[model samples]
Target: MEITRSRDFTAERAWGAKDIANMNGITTRLHWTDQPYRWHVNDGEEVFVVLDGQVEMRYRSPEGERSQLLEVGDIFFASVGTEHIACPIGEARVLVVEKEGSV
Candidate 1:
């Protein structure tokens, strides 16, 4: 077993991540970012969890667009083909689980 302290995580680039695990084709990662992620649709489902700080989770829907403020411990599920983007409110740590090599 391994222990990870999400809040202490850092990266040299925006949305940089530390590989945590890869099992059954799913990849678990710890990401550190102070900027926004590009808008894209994942090829598979995604489990995005905010571990520290806050994030502005934005998505596009048939209803146009929508967004939410994600705090620590908040989880956002993005199903396959869901278009979305993540913009950190300053510095934030996020744990992401998705298909291996998914964008």
Candidate 2:
């Protein structure tokens, strides 16, 4: 078993992630980032959980472009083909679950 503290996490690069689990080709990662990610669509569904800090989640849909503020414990569900981007308000920790190599 392993234990990790979200608040104590840090990385050398923007959006660096630690591999937590890989089961049945689905991967779970713990990410630390202070920058915005590029907009892209996931090939499969995604479960994005904020472990610490806040973020502005922007997405493009058939209706139009929209954004939401996500705080700690917030979960953003990105369905397949949902174009989205994550802009962290500051240094934030996140847990992402999705099919391996979805990016």
| Best of the candidates, lDDT | 1
lDDT of 1 by residue, 1-103 (tens): 9998888889999999999999989999999999999999999999999999999999998998999999999999999999999999999999999999999
Query: Residue pairs in steric clash, candidate 1?
Result: none
* Backbone clash total, candidate 2: 0
Off by over 4 Å in 1: none
Candidate 2 stretches with Cα past 4 Å from truth are: none
lDDT of every predicted structure (CA atoms): 0.96, 0.95
Error of 2 at 100 (Å): 0.5
TM-scores, all models, native as reference:
0.97, 0.97
lDDT of 2 by residue, 1-103 (tens): 9988878888999889999899999999999999999999999999999999999999999999999999999999999899999999988999999999998
